[model samples]
Each structure stands twice: as structure tokens, then as C-alpha cells.
Target: MSLTPLNEDLGVLRFITAGSVDDGKSTLIGRLLYDSKSVLTDQLSALSRAKHKRTAGEDIDFSLLTDGLEAEREQGITIDVAYRYFATARRKFIIADTPGHEQYTRNMVTGASTAHAAIILVDATRVTEVDGQTELLAQTKRHSAIVKLLGLQHVIVAINKMDLIDFSEARFNAIRAAYLELAQRLGLQDVRFVPVSALKGDNIVFASEKMPWYQDEPLLDVLESLPVAEQDGELRFPVQLVARQDGSQADDFRGYMGRVESGAIRVGQSLRVLPSNRSATVAEIVGPSGLLDQAFAGQCVTVRLAEDVDVSRGDTFVSTESALQPSRKLGADVCWFDEEPLSPQRKYLLKQATSTVYVRVGSVDTVLDVTTLSHGTDKTTLAMNDIGAVQLSLQKPLAADTYDSHPATGSFVLIDEATHHTVAAGMIRTLAA
Candidate 1:
């Protein structure tokens, strides 16, 4: 529960939960926190009071733990992303319990963008409910693509609510087969399906007894055992800000501060400072270690260079030989979240990493019909929750990589030029390629 210190040796994991309502997304999280002994006494009392207000004969309704908004509590459904934090001895986790309804599909894209892993809840039933009218097939297609676009290849499919369906082995298998087929088409990696009754705490932290027909490594074991990417593959450090902490002949310290999005960096290593092709050697690494000569990826550290380079927020650092090309034009996959349709005539603020630039839609080359995940050619604009491929021209250049390569640098959010509210989430495919 304490803040992660620079020297704490803590590895943080961000996870997002997506599932239909009453499928036990909230209840499972509530149980994890309560059983893990992370909930406080006062919080439990609040839960007790909340339970008293519900109609008689209803379950404890653990969804109240995350349905914080009054409108959501009134509607009895999650309407936005509710973040919760809990920890074990091994690693600390930040959970994003997002809405399951099709209307709130944008929230799933928003939460999944920052998550390292995604837990998709599925109801185990004899028949798959494909609402032909609305909110069924289209919702699934949208969510599946969002997860893939967010660069989360480690997907854990929690096939929940076995109790309602009699915990039948056949039922679990049917649902698992369908979801696996979807995963395969998306080119997901390490995709797994675990059957459990989230409301009854079956096969979540441990194995379920009601379904002796099912046998697999417990869900918690799978979560803890998933592989994390290496510390340094290709270094991409986008400068957030620059600080001149001290200046003297003996110690002239000029530090470029930013979260290391990817890859490790070492002191005395040569780096190319972008926007001003000046190259220098890393002189010092300043962090909780308090001014060293090097640091690894995923840590927030200020890097000092041997030369006083004209670097600032929105700049990027990389190996001089392998520096990424910066550009003002880009090709992207955009998920529109605004009610108004996207127009090429209007411009919006494209916030990628620490850079903010105004970008106009040069061409919406194509949009997926969504229901089919098929490309619709000759597309000009998009409506709410619409997924499409867009070409853009920016007022200023940004340093970016493809989402598949480095998520931190490749993903961006579109800000309404007037309202300043984020209206869309986008993934850069390449630098104007």
C-alpha cells in the first residue's frame, strides 16, 4: 500500500478486467481484495450497509465495490474505469475494472491501453448469446480488437459463472473453443482459458470442486507465472522535461527527465538527442539511487549527458546508430470515442508520450464494419466507438514507434481541440510509411 520507492525492487503489473455484467467481474475482484486481506474494516462496513439497501434475497452484490459513480450505482452497472490497487509479496497489481456493456466499449480500449495483461470474463452456457439486434457480436469484435491493439498478447480468458450453468464440462469447453477461435484470428500470444465461478470463488485463487471434470493450473498460478518482456530490447526514452539541478565547474549537472518507456540505458553510453541531431555520452543516472551513471527501463530516472544538449520535454533519446526517425505525418488505427463523427476538416491535439501536437485527418482510408471486423474501403469519417485506419498530418513532429514494437511511444490519445477532453485513442502503425 505504500508508494513504490526507487530502490524497492518492486515490479508493478497493470491488469484490466472485461466481461458481461453479473458475470462476476466485480465480485471476483472484491473477493481477491477481501480474501487477500487488503480491504480495511471501514470499507467492509460500507459494503455491509450497501448490501442492506439492496432488495431482499439478492446476493451480496460485490459490484458495489467498484461502481463508485452515482449513476452507475443507480443503474447497477459499471459505466467507467474504476481502478483498484492490491499487492502480494511477489508483485504489486493495479486492476482496471471496466464496463462490460457495449455502449461503454470505449472504456475497455482506454483501460487496456495501459495494461500489461487483460482478463476477459466469459459466461459458460450451453448456448452463446449473440444478440442479433444489438450489443452482442459487434461488442465482441470491438473488444477483441481493442485488446490486440493495446499490445496485450498475454490474455487470460476467465470463463466465469459455472454455477449458473451447472458447472458442466461441455459448457466450459464450448465457450473456451469459441473464445480461442477469436484469439487465434487476432494473432494473440499465450492465450489461455480458465473456467471458474467468480461469484463462488471457484478456480480463481484455487481450483473449483464443483467441476471435477475440469483440470488446469489454477487461475492465480497462471497470472503469477506469465512472462514479462525483457528490460531492454530497443531503447526508447521520450523526454518528459529537462532540469538544471545544479551548475558549477566541479559538477555541471543538466538532466533530461522522463519515464523510460522501453529498454535499459547505461552511463558512459553514447546517445542521439533528437530534434537537434546532437549526440553525447550519458554522464549520470539520477534516481532513488541518487545520481548514478546508468539505469534500466521501466524506471523513472533523470539522465545527464556529457554535453549541454538543447533537449526538452517531447524529445527522445536513443542509440546514435539506431535512433528512430521522427516525423509529423503518421498512419494510425483510431478508436473514436466521441459522439460527433470525426471530420477531416477539423484538427485535434494528438498526445503521444510527452509530445502534444495538433493533427488533421489527411485521410480516413478505411474503417472496419466492426460487426464483421472486415475493412470498409473509401471511408471518410467515423462515428462513436468506430474503429478505422487514418492518415494524419501533425503541426509538429513526434518520435514514435509501432504499437507492436514499443507501446509507450506508439500509442496516443486524441484531445478535442476546443474541449481538451480526450475523444479517441490511437495506435501509430509507422512513421508516415
Candidate 2:
């Protein structure tokens, strides 16, 4: 099978590593960084002198490179998301090492929210074989389901600890078959498999001679070659702050300041402000360096509209020709993160992009069973770490798009009004009628 060509303009690839506990997520990342010579001299010395070394005979414990928390080191498990940066000659990378435990699913969601791809580490030893059928761990299935729900562009399943299983080709095939079934059920399209031993650095940065049956490129090469998710070419500029210069010597200036979440904006372009449905033409586009003729996605700029319109921090500037519409009712898939169950009666704060509005759960439509990869409508309450589809009623309309089409503007979080804590993360699936 051929791989997708990488987009050189993407510059940096952001990805998250996830799996069950002791599945070698952190170790795999450590191996990638160490094998690619991304580790510095001081870090290497510290690894040698550190006391929590898991490996024997001064064989550097690779997991120490990540797992930086004191409690994480003591427990030998990742509790919080740890971000690390490294670069190869061909591409730069940002890795989010997420916790594998089921309780920390929120952290995994947080890390995966901004990532373009995911590296799911599956322990070969964790799978049980019976009559040529393999059973994957519950956490592994749950992570894969979450990957599909988040709409990740690429998924690389690194079957880790090949050395522990004696590099058996039959075992690898069985596990791959089982995972392929799961991927098909979860609707994961761009999936690739590689057998690796994070401990021994096999098939991580270089091809492992022991696994000669595996003809595919190593994990690093696959990552470098995978295409990044392209942002849609519709302007989505959420107004973060309304800049004003009232007492200046020059004429009074009013500009809407924010980062271009997606798409491009240029002078003379027509834009429609959200919720208000006010139209205006772009008069000036100013960047950090000074005036700019045009600004694309991920750029922070201040825009001056030709006509003064009532724009605020929460207002979004959208392309006049774009299909996105303002809606008060949203159909979304939400992952509950709070200890309290989802209460339709309680008022919650819905924060999407720069806007925060009061919202209520209109109804719980379906709850996902990660093990079976099925949705059930019989459920009512969603406890902590539960994934469910629900209809939300907003006090005000939001200019939003479906998460599958435009992730930056289509995602939101539910905040508890009483405690001021985020209770759930939601992805828009449908709009108001």
C-alpha cells in the first residue's frame, strides 16, 4: 500500500500518543526522540544520574525522558499530558504524551484536540489469542473510538513490545487483524500498522532486522510521510478583543483583534459578523510586524472594517460567501469530564472559540459503548469520562460549522456555572432547524 504525500507547507506536525497503561506510549516517544538525536547532552546526563531508573545495569530508562511529574515518576505512569518538541531534517514535530489510564481520558482529549494525527501504542503482549482470533484491551478500543470521534486525519498503530513476544510474525498478524476490524467498525480510514519494540528501539527510527517480514517503513518515516489535515478555506476570525485608540493624535481607530482560526483574510474582502449578521468590508489588515496585505490561518492580526459595526470579543468574522450559519440549537457529541452526572436541568456555560454563552442540555440522544463501538439510546445520565450525543439549547446563536468540516469553530466546552469548571467537551454534528 502507498502512503499519502506529506504537505511541506504544514511546517510542523502535531500528534498525540495514547494507549493502555504500560503500553509503552512514553517509551515509544522517548525512543523516537533519542534515536533521532533530539535529546540534549544535559538531558542524557540527567537520565544516567536519575534515581527512578526502571532499566537495570545503567541501561537508560527511556520513559524518564517524558513522564516528568514527580508522582508520575514514582508511579511509573503518565498522569498529565507532557508535550515535547523535536525535529528531523525533513520535518518538525510536536508530540503530546497523554496518559493511558481510563480516568485521565480528559487529558487525552485535551491533547488530541489540536493534533493532526495520533500514534496509538498497542502492547503485543496485552492481546489474547484464541482460535486465530485476538482480543484487544478495553483501553485500546476506547482510545481508537475516541480517535475516530475526534476526526483525526491519520492514525498509526504501533504494536509495541515486539521483543517481549519474540518478534513472532503470526502474533503480529493476529493483532493486526483484530485492530483492523476495530478500525473498520469505528470508521477510521487512514490507518497503518507497524511492529515495534520501544524498549529496544526496533522499527521506531530504523527498520528492525528481526522483523524482516514487515516490509513497511519505520514509525518515524510513516509519521513524516503522513499528510497533515488541511484547514478549510473559509475565514473564521473570532474577535478576542476590540482594539481602540481614542486619544491618539491620528484619527480615532477601532480594530477587531484576534487570530485567524482558519482560512485567509485580505484587504477589501467582505465579512459578516456573527450573531448580529452585520456586513462590512475589510479596510485594513495589520499584523505584529505592521500592515499586511493578507493574513492566513494561524495568524494574529487586527482588522479594521470599512464601516464601523457593533463588534465585540465574542463576535466572529466569517466570509460572506461561506455556508456557515448562526444557530441557537446544536446537536453535538460530548465527552463528559466532571464527576457529577450530566444534568439537563442545570444551566451550563458553553464556550466556543472566543464566545461564552449560557447553554442547557436539551436531551441526551445516544451514549457510546466503546467496547462494542455502538451507540445506545436507552441511557439518560452520563458520568465521568462518558461519551454521549446530546442536543444543546443556547441562549444566543453561534456562527458554527460541523466539526468534521471546520474543527476550530465547531468544537466547544461545557462549563459548570456554579463551580466555573469545564464539565465536557463537545463537537458540533448538526445545526438548528
Candidate 3:
């Protein structure tokens, strides 16, 4: 059997799979790829060889498809994000398989940040504690909170390994009810629950006859029908490069190159450069095929201005009416990843789009408890994998917006000056207010 290409009109659906360690995230992804016939002949042969290393049963171990690292295969756990691409007759998909361990919470956030939806796996057998107590897993709750905070509207909670439990509807309902309560508290939208067994291929790619109880469509069906978020806002173009393709002659044409972050831009549209506050009219729209009438969100195009303004990399061009405010102080939510613990004493480099500047932690307002969803008053420091609200003082004014308003200009990363390593991912909430 061969994989089929989707209709060109069918847009892509990007989603992420995340759950606690050993919850069958890898196996679920493997089942999707394998059953869809997206796996190549050579890859199937490799899976056959790897199956013996991890499985002793007759059924193929689908988890081998995503556990790419030797350490992960040896330890039997996911360590980093593994991206897989596939297509069906209905829709194309890009799936990011994220790690479930608490230490890798930062990795999960990175994987889910750009995802249009999230698939959270829950092993039915382990939904309860050893004492027969019904409780949600800490890591599971952490991932869910992060998913909501990232503004992902679609969520699927797949109750996997139902075959081992004899496909008990009561067990699935219990977990579903508990998770629904959590989803409500987190304000998640369009949450769905499905019962499945990745190993047995039940309720995955097609309906499972083993249960005969579930009437809803399988996981793949739900995924294909999920709606992607709409990009609705005014034009926001952050200049990445200023090119003079012909030569540096004053008369030679120069172009400001960047991707349109939102809205539409066309020739003769008025734009204001941020921080500099210089205004220019779009004189020409240049694309690979020559001239273009307009450019919209997600398109990369070069723009020429009516007048030669002193624009350079890191400057943002925005719609004259919907320009973002420039600020030196910001209140944001940050996920700290460094083991070095965040403190006000230390300073770091803030990188937002093409702009980079020095910044320091002004204050940490509160730290979130994943399980309880409670806030802890903390103003001094944050540890690894901690999600907290903090205020930042920037060395220079940054053109920014609230994440709820415009995500492209509302997010940033903090880099360690000494190691040049990314220490935090931040989402702005307010600018000096």
C-alpha cells in the first residue's frame, strides 16, 4: 500500500501529542503513521528490528517509530520533540511528539507553542493511584495548563490502553469527567475525549469493533475535522533584512524583506516603523515571481517604500492605525528552563523577533502550582521548569503587544549573556501597567 496525497485545497493541521512518561504518546503516533500507510518500506524494516529490542509479543511495537534517540530507546522514554509529517485524502498534518517527564516540561511547551491543537494521552490503567485513589497526574495537568496558556483552542484527551481494561466505559467516563472539570477551569475550548488502544489499533484510524460501545469517530477522524485558528489583525511586519540586490548605488532599488505577521499589505498602504516612528507608503511589493498586488499574514515578501527611510533589521513596520506601543518595561509570563534559578541580580539578553536587547528580571509576581492551579507569592527567584509571572526592564524600548491581542509581537526569549543559551520563554501581558 502507498500513502496518498491530500487535496491542495485542504490546508494543514498542526497538532502536538503530550502526556506523562510511558503514557503511550510514542505508540499513538506510531499507530497513526503505520495504519495510515505513511511508513516507508525501509522504515518498516527498521521497526521490525527494533521491535525485538523492546517487545516480545507478536504485534508490532509502534513506539519504535518515534523513540529515535538511543538513550530514549534504552530508557524507554521520550527526551525531545519528534516531528512527523503525513497526509490523507482529506487533510495534511504535522504532529509534534513532546516528552512527558516533568524535567522536560520546557520541551513540551516549545513543541505545543506553535501547534493548532494538542492531543493529551492518558493510560487508562494508570489513571488511578496505587491506593485505588482517582487523581490527575501532575505532569498531565502541567501540560494541559501550558497548552491553554499557549492559546491552543483545540484539545483531545485520548484515553489509551483501553484494551487492557476490557474497554470499560465506566473507567473512561470517570477519567473524562475529571478531565472535563480541569479543562473548564483552564478555559480550554473544543475539548474532546476518546477511548483507544494504540497497540490494538482500536478507535485510532477507524472504528473499533472490540468495544461496540463508542459511537464517535476515531482519533484520525476528529483530527481531520478540527478547525485551525484564524489570523485576524492589522499588518505587523518586523524587518529582518534590508537588501540592495543590484548595487549600493543611491539610485539602485532597496527592499525591506520580512514575513507579514498579520493582516494584508499592498502597494500604496501606509505603514509606520516602530521605535523609530517613521512613516512610509508601500511603493512596490516584490516577490520571487516579480511584482505582487498584496501580501497577507504568513507570506514572505519584500517591500519597497515611497521614500528611502533609515529602516534596518529589528525595526517593525505596522499599520499606521494599529501600531503597537513601544515600552521599556513589560509584565509577562515566563517559563524558566535554566537550572541556574532566575534572580533579579542577573541580567540576560531579550530576543524578540529580529530585535535583541539586554533585560533583567524586575520582579516575579507569582508562581503557578500545576496540580492545584494555585498561585504562590514569589518575588525573588524561579527554579527550572517553573511558570511564573514576572516584570522585565529592557535596556531599550521594545515594540510589543499583549499575547491575547497579537502573538507574533507578544512573545520573547531570554538568553544567558555568558553562555548565549536561551533561559526563558515569555509571553507579554501588559506594558508597564
lDDT of each: 0.77, 0.91, 0.88
Residue pairs with backbone atoms closer than 3 Å in model 1 (clashes): 285-292
Error of 1 at 236 (Å): 2.1
- Arrange candidates, best TM-score first: 2, 3, 1
Q: How do the predictions measure up, each by TM-score?
A: 0.88, 0.96, 0.95
Worst 10 residues of 1 by lDDT: 1-10
Q: Write the per-residue lDDT of candidate 2 for residues 1-433, one digit (tens) a residue.
A: 2354444443789999999999999999999999999999899899988888888876878899999998999999999999999987668899999999999998899999989899999999988966757989988998888888899889999999999989999989888899999998888999999999999999999999999899999999888877775795788999999988895757899999999999999999999998898999999999999999999999999999999789999999998997777899999999999999999878999999999999989899999988777899998879999999999999988888889878988999999989998999999999993
Model 2, which residues run further than 4 Å from truth?
Answer: 1-10, 130-132, 247-250
The positional error of residue 48 in candidate 1, measured at the CA in angstroms, is: 2.2
RMSD of each: 4.6, 2.0, 2.8
Question: For model 3, where is the 10-residue window of minimal lDDT?
Answer: 1-10
Using lDDT as the measure, name the better of candidate 2 and candidate 3.
2
Tell me the number of clashing residue pairs for each predicted model. 1, 0, 0
Return whichever of 1 and 2 wins on TM-score: 2
- Candidate 3 structure quality by residue, lDDT tens digits, 1-433: 1122354345889999988999999999999998999999888777777733566754567887888998888888999999999998888899999999999989998998788999999999888754664678888889998998888879999999999999999898889988998889888978999999998899899899987888888999888877777777888899999988778575898899999888889999999998888889999999878899899999899999998789989999998997476899999998999999997868999999888989989888999999798878944788999999998999988888888888888888999999988899989889962
**Models sorted by lDDT, best on top:** 2, 3, 1
Best by TM-score: 2
